[model samples]
Target chain A: MSEDPGSPKPIVTFLGPVASYTHQATLDAFSSSDFTLTPVVTIDDVFASVQSGTSHRGVVPFENSSNGSVVFTLDLFADLQHKYPDIIVCGESYIAVQHCLLGHPDSHHASHPISVSERTGGSRVGSGVIESPLSSGAVTPTSAIPNPQKPTARPVGDLARIKKLYSHPQAWGQCKIFLNAYLKGVERQDVSSTSRAAQLVAEDLTGESAAVSSVIAAKIHGLEVLARGIEDRGDNTTRFFVIRKRAEAEVGDATSVDRKEIGKDEQGEGDWKTLVSFTIDHANPGSLAHSLAVFEKYGLNLTSINTRPSGVENWNYIFFVELKGRREEGIEDGPVNKALKSLYGVCRSWRWLGSWENRLAR
Target chain B: MSEDPGSPKPIVTFLGPVASYTHQATLDAFSSSDFTLTPVVTIDDVFASVQSGTSHRGVVPFENSSNGSVVFTLDLFADLQHKYPDIIVCGESYIAVQHCLLGHPDSHHASHPISVSERTGGSRVGSGVIESPLSSGAVTPTSAIPNPQKPTARPVGDLARIKKLYSHPQAWGQCKIFLNAYLKGVERQDVSSTSRAAQLVAEDLTGESAAVSSVIAAKIHGLEVLARGIEDRGDNTTRFFVIRKRAEAEVGDATSVDRKEIGKDEQGEGDWKTLVSFTIDHANPGSLAHSLAVFEKYGLNLTSINTRPSGVENWNYIFFVELKGRREEGIEDGPVNKALKSLYGVCRSWRWLGSWENRLAR
Candidate 1:
């Protein structure tokens, strides 16, 4: 498809007020110069924007390394596909999560030193260094009060001074170790997004409040990073998907094929993953297992499997299966097709969510 | 087992600050007269209480009809079973969720009529009738202001006056229809539990605040139910599990057996279910499907299946499966046992969570 020179750049909507992980993922996938990045209030808005044709693409989180799948996104994929059939998963990217303790920069107590007597055992009680990528390897203590009497004991910033901690629920789980050790009994207020948490703390200008967010969010909101890399796990990461409307083939390109056949020629190269969701008859024993057997018969690799309640009745579920192949040549025809055809006969219902190049290979 | 005449009543701990759904479920499972019901701060606390032998039994929510499985509880089950092997599931129960809008009774504008012009289209409009089981088959309009000019139109309690909507995140989802309708842009503050939300609203005595919780919770917190049965769906229900320490057989009981043979006599009766968790070799194609086939071979019906990341690596997951049968009779000697033995040979790891009499059959 050729772009008109004068036409406005395509808008990419993502889950955010700004500087959220989804916003960072959107930036990683598309160049800011080529596309206008817009932040919406919720994940539903991201899908709605693409479905309404207001935005050309939408970015949303699919899963986290430590927390498992984002169930709401999976449920939306099941609910919205029937209406927005053209919207497909086109690309995927991963973002390393680094949670930081953010506080008001101008507050007088921002650099107050934590008393040695207050340091609980097992808590990270060393010098409270704000570890940024730009910082040197040595710990740069941010505390204003440096006790010379205890040279061996490094002074750390006082976390006890903060009465309220604002963060997304997921962030709380990620920073459980830090919260449990140092900030135990502090009031934790759950916000819609981490960026919003940073924004609240920044806007309040209260030294008494802090937020668990990213350095990017702290920077954007004009907040100070009191501590960094506070997540319980070092390998904390979130995978995001870039979704766009399915387009028809252009007339000029000789090799161009129908949208349905876009991934056919690229199949069997082992660089694609397709996601499909289906519901089986709960009354029948092994119905799900039998349907899954078809994948083995086709020599297909099942990458992931998840289940969510169908909401119709107790114990009824809709299963989402991610397979190692594309939709066209890799899955739509031959053995994969045969398995799906058989699945169609036995299962109550099923649908293909999308096929995209596997991001793990990167 | 025989109860000692002078022994203290068994203590049952559940996730609670009191008046939470788990508290309600715990009440439903055992009579207060026979058990000393205790409330804990978190789900982890409930498990800790059971493992530490501080409480004889623990109650926790397993699944919701609308929202799907509680992943935290599932993850805790996987983590705690290795440490507390003897703490097995003893029973199950279900509680119908009836969310109500609660406010302080002494507030001057507690029964103010909702302005028709204030409601945005998607929010629940028209007469807001609070449905209660005690009321006859008639709409109970609690509005203090009755507009005599519009005789046919039912005046409803004003939601616009509510400045803050406090609730558990799940409660917010369940009451979205009502929230979106009347209190369009109100600030939503997420609390630790729904009952805590009620407690906050009741304590504030501010005519400006409200909470989304159960009528029972409102009563417990000394608040008035402004509106009842406000959840979007009528079938909203949560299933809870009763857990207790394994007991050794007494000499006098004729039916007494070892813990290994606990469910043997109860099998083939079609009134029991078992929960098991296992991790399969992710590299192998259809290894999970193959393992699941053993259930079908045994003529055992699979009730539900869910997957959570094992936290080892990406694309690596631990699957939780619930089957229709007891452990000793339905699983130990016959097809279920054979299937599990085969699964043990193929799977990387597997563990039995527990077996309990099926509450659905009741």
Candidate 2:
């Protein structure tokens, strides 16, 4: 990918290996002509890249419907934002994970067998002694037998009987509570990924192991699903952010000639999401409540609030808040921004995380 | 571990080998002596053990400050409550995780040295860099030599220069934005735990690998620290729950006696956290809003709210809420429980996730 050095598009870094989900999302967010995409290997690198000017911005996972908050992501933004004034959140994207269970073909059949038992009764009245024969060839008709030759058919017993459970640690952690109750006496292990767990379960010769992973994993691994729809919440979704350098102000007067050339297509109606990170002057009293009041005064609906101690002394805090509004819609000079500006003494540094409607949502 | 059948203590089943953190928390909540403890393998087993009457309760993780709500746990409750009518929640616990990084000693100094660099010419510029030199024997004036006797520091190159990036997947994910930023083009992998990640990073002979894990991992694995405080969020915490079969009303009364006995030693000022899981008749339009109003009317502080769609078709939605009050506190049942009970038509089931206060406040 080669381009002019003096282009408007900023470099946005994300974790990737080309086809990784993060990479796919990056492609969805920016067109090849509009942005320069760089795949980084760590969230810290995302921060450093932006701070060191190697990349204009970086994107990372913050939260999922199944998981609460990507604590590490939250921590980084909360801690480093004040020191590095240039970094800020621009926007977020929501992704739905379609999950399924997979295993080796006919894994269930190999582990569990269905046997029809024939019992002869009338030996002792109503409490008659009846003999049920096992599915093995026996010399005497009355002799009891074990199915030595029959393929082992392990009954998928109650959750209690499950001895082993596998899944990605993150996925497993989310399902921790229910798994504890149902598989009370079972062992839980974290594999590489949910898909890898499914692969392991499918390859298990005894069928005693089961994987709690995505449906995609099951399909890819060719495993028989013992159970399905095993998540705690139905509205399971994960939100991804598209971090970019704060967009430069539009030069309307300077672009008088170009104004006529600007196509109407660029005027598409877009939803707005404003992300602001600020620190309270102190930690004591109602400082947090007071800091939140700035947004409340402007009738802004705060979508999410994440906080982390600034790591300085005395419990100073850095807060990341997502609110609804755009600066271009005269919002930059609006009451909310104005109110934020007024608290310049109390507020540490308030930077916007940009606003954009999700392409998928559109 | 032995007790009279007539004087049975509450039994809570959880996945464990006794040393597990969940097992320790369970003992802390119920007291090792007053309640018989059963170890299960999975969260499902814990619930099944209770449902099958083998154990009275179960404990498992639901959400972590670092992660999120355990999705599978929530899904299991929504489904099982439909199958069994008597199961209920009784308590909750929040645990702090202090992670240490660990690895092998030989490779401890594999990464860049952690020290302030001294630059000549008045030292106007300073940048963090990773470098390894191949020179074993050389000496020259400080100003002229590039320091070849030992590995002279160069900027840490891509993962191709390093063997791999290691850490728990969650940690990796949290630091992903940063990792990718710094190691813009590298390979990332997950180990079973942060300690394991550090261990492998230290063991790698290639000297091109590093792990983004807990401080605990570095200590345990005997690896030199590369970077610390890698999480995105500073206040990373996880919440755990203790669930059990609803004790007979008389049994609850009996447990109070046990509480009093223990209270004598530990300052009896135990706090209560009420957890409730319920479902509204999915067909109703304003059913959920009306149900939530019950808590508002009673002035109950709703701590958390999570929604899950019932896997079974038509009979949809299961809502999990954490509230502040205990049944026996005579905290005034008020209109909420009464309203819940009255909604026999819409309300499905409600249970408490017990609450506890130790050094940490809920």
Candidate 3:
């Protein structure tokens, strides 16, 4: 997947300081060697990077299976559409999120010496174990560096010794079952991202703090993983969108972007989805119903529907709807085009967020 | 509003350690002298208190004007309906959330002497300010207690001197404009609640830390307010529900419970609302459209709709719908009853969370 020496590799930016779930998704969707990956501080930064043309592409977490929609991402889409109409979701990928209880290696209780080698069976920290290429390559050198003095056995910690637990708020909610059983009453602090929590624990080696983060984060920050897969559900997955600005020629090409050929069925049909957002007349009782009926009328399948406060007024909302069809397919008389045309007639305002190949099954 | 000497005051529990926005809402809805208000650690605890009949009522935040839905409250309602079907939303109250920059009096930088007198005009530290009764009464005695030694001028803090800012995640979002403008690069830490953030800052007293919380929190914790109304919007508000367990005879009695009669309009027709959650067949693309159509067919106005992961399977979701009618008023050939009957026919599973007197205008 590495690019030729003469070719200028496209830069891909994602929400991160590195080792975040978004970073993992970015790696999954694009080959690191083929693209120069950069980490931005916030989700807004990811959008700004793509919008400003500083980065050729960007990735962001759209939703978590357990936590439902990421309101920040949805709200940003609504705001960015008007400002940067050419920005579109080019592709998407899912990463299975497994949260681990991570602590500063020095903070482990002396009574329980748990070495990194013992946990991974000496497979080298984060090497081929977490399915993240960045974590494996980034942490291998750090783990190989020998201490000047002989290293003492690293201590393993429990809830009793951990005075503080840091993680993204979503991670805390995902691991509620484990937290309630073991770390009940522990002070949980939320950080901007899970990797930031790990970085903080590493920086403040008080030996009294732990972070709920990904194994990749623990490896990148040289923290020890005390427990793995701590989320309440085993099937915890987060879907991320790989977005990019449309080309100059593609400015008004809402239904003409070339669809990527991947995950095709035997019938030679590739699954695809389109995202759109719009506002309706708040005074009409059945305005939402009338708007949604256009999909049914056009024989289009609606995958998801979410409502967010418009922030303009109380009880006023904007709806984000995902439909199961590509914008380009069967155009001129396609179900998606027909449904969208009828939708514009009913909605007060509307915008096409993007259309991309669908990855998640119905 | 005080109860008779012989009468036992009803116990009211809310999500709190006191000085929380929920506490303010509880006070606004019920007279403190008439009801013995208690602080519970979590929203779940508040629900448990009401479900177990340990408290006459419980108060929990329903939504924030800026951040939109409180998914925790919505998810809890979906879960609690099956276990305690009799528990209902009896009433509601709104609290205007004004976030204050609270810090330890001694932590201010030496160069900037920001006295409480200078910022609040010697207003007795949250005294007669901020509409919350809890702030006025609970902190008055402490604020009145003068130090034996003459007080030195407390130094005011700027963004550069503060090393960390603590607040609820919602507060961080609410005060984004202020934070981005003044404290661009300061480390932001998320606590359980706004008041809890104040408590932590008060406990640490490092002089380099601050909290974004209510004026009530600052007063109770003896912290000085460096600034007030720091939220992005002036009309920032959070709505809370006053919930109670219904009696056996009142199980089906949606109306006719003793109405508290606070904030009632002169017309005597109290607006009513009902909340219900249902899941539909994921394979059926138009199932949700069909289910929502039931509301339009029966003329029930939907004020809000939110989607949450059912948590049982991937791509499966439960829809929470808030409509403008009470269960009893539109039952027995009413629109609400007819709409619900049709909804049940289309959904895979459904539960009636509760119906309460509507407080927020459409």
Candidate 4:
């Protein structure tokens, strides 16, 4: 859906430095739209852009592969709700964080170059005919490159050539098996970020180092795939929420703001899910159980329920419950509205956070 | 309790510098013990130290004030369960993170030095009689220092003397109002950690720079207090779990393992809280609700509940439920034992993570 050429293109911002995973997700979310993509330094800035009407939409990480909730983002919602009450989630998109070992273009590759795409079930890397290394088959290492001056075979002895491995400290644990099995004792240098590791490798084209970074970073920084899918564990996929300001929210024009219809697209009624956060009288042991039952009573199956500490007090928590609902119906007539009304009695405080397309079910 | 002087002190490790909040909490947990307090570079190392028996006990962050679950710590439990199956949580402790504006002993203080202890109601800074800034009172700046060279009153004009402020990037947002009101034009430098910030100011001793760091850091680095409780929002109190290796568990003699008695102390049965994680068949909409209901039926009050992505699949999650229970009795005779057996019927898989003292109730 491209907008009118004459109209100012709606700005979309994400936690950036172009080839970061969040940037990759932002590009995929607005691939066909006429929106202009901008990079923000922090997630808080991404929310601020939408909240201030500087951007029509913002993409911020909602969940991590290993961590169900992106606490940084959730905490922002709790902290900034007062500053920007109209900020709401419109849609969500997921990006698989399949880390790859990148190298300078002239660097050597692994002996058996399994097709990264094939092993990862055709990730953003797209289709490849080569088989996985686990199945007793491997693609030629030269086939991994788009252009090759030296299309020689992957010398098994090349392990000695990699004098140093570069990656963010967080990546080291994920690739322990690989590091032990292949590059044992190779000097490892910790960089600030995975993308930064790739940039370093690209800049210093000595072909003596490799970085564990994203495929997008390799492509953006002119690095070659040394060995794909270097991460031996914690196969992570991050989900991001595309958010925007409710129309006319700044002027306090409540009549023009459609609360229930937020971020609704061509998806069917069954595809939409609404997320709400509430705090119960935690001193009362039964309050939380009673609140969960209310959602079940309305036949609103909670797809996900998580808790974040309400910063107002040390141990007090705000429970985030997401459930299927129809967004077409107005807030007053919607089943979510009715369930929330019942849920409120058991809650000390509550807020309807947002509604978005349920990627989990899809 | 003092151990035998002849015996080696039980080594306890934490994520640290000598004065990080984690270090502060670790000291508090073993205040009177004949234990060695060692510092580790990463949380994973802290876990590994206990798992490998390098440390008798390890203190790691379990929950953040704004995030109910410490994702890094929780994800480690999920990732390393098989490696350290007998690693059990022994106890927990809480530390209030009261950010202080620290400076070299010779640096200038704020105009109105309100008593931090009075305002925060006795953080680890302990008791002081000066009323809070809100209560319209000020303590002479020199009184804040142990051996003041100058006992003169705080000059509001001294705000212009601050050429730069150092802090971890995370602290800037927490103290926005204070920064805006006083140090608006000061050059802010981002350091690696809050403790490091205090060190910078201490080593420089320029009196023209200050740091936003923990009070503990100020004491450790010999920095004088300039202002206290600078964080205007998101009053964060982190909870830490003190973990230890279960005795003789690497032998895999399950029969000899007494799970319920893993971490019994002077605390009564009513003070204990057990945390367990499980995954349910998400295909059925009622599975989670059913799992939650089993707890209510068993009279277990769920103190906290959170979800983490299973990491095996994109949308799949493992639920963490913490409930108040008695652990003195044998596992077979305990009320939690019956509830988990009943709870497992609704789940595809489960694990009894650990039990600890619920510090929140106190």
List DockQ, one per candidate, in order: 0.46, 0.06, 0.44, 0.26
Among the numbered candidates, top lDDT falls to 3
Residue A141 lDDT (model 2):
21
Clash pairs, candidate 3, are A107-A207, B107-B207, B114-B155, B114-B156
Question: On DockQ, who's better, 2 or 3?
Answer: 3
Considering DockQ, which of the candidate structures 2 and 4 is the better prediction for this target? Answer: 4
Model 2 chain B is weakest, by summed lDDT over 10 consecutive residues, at B134-143
Superposing all C-alpha atoms, what RMSD in Å does each candidate have to the true structure?
7.3, 13.6, 9.8, 11.3
Model 3: how far is A294 from its true place, Å? 2.2
lDDT for model 3: 0.72
The segments of candidate 3 whose C-alpha lies over 4 angstroms from its true place after superposition are A1-6, A80-82, A106-161, A247-270, B1-7, B80-82, B106-160, B247-257, B264-270
Question: What are the clash counts of all predictions, listed in order?
Answer: 4, 116, 4, 0
**Residue range A27-77, candidate 3, lDDT tens digits:** 877676667788888888888888888787889999999898888888888
Cα lDDT tens digits, model 1, B1-362, are: 22344857777888887889999898887677767778888787788788778887789988888778888788887772366655667678889887887875423533453334443233443222333222132223455434312222221344444677789877877766766655656667777789998988877766667888887887788777766677767678889988766544311111321222222344435677778788888888667777676676677778788888786776688888888876664335755566677777767888766777677742
Ten residues in sequence with the least summed lDDT for candidate 4 chain A = A148-157
List of chain B TM-scores, one per candidate: 0.79, 0.62, 0.80, 0.71
List, in the given order, the native-contact fraction of each candidate: 0.51, 0.00, 0.52, 0.48
Candidate number that wins on lDDT, 1 or 2:
1
Off by over 4 Å in 1: A1-8, A80-82, A110-156, A247-268, A329-332, B1-6, B106-155, B246-268, B329-332
Per-candidate TM-score against the hidden true structure: 0.82, 0.53, 0.81, 0.68
Per-chain TM-score, chain A, candidate 1: 0.80
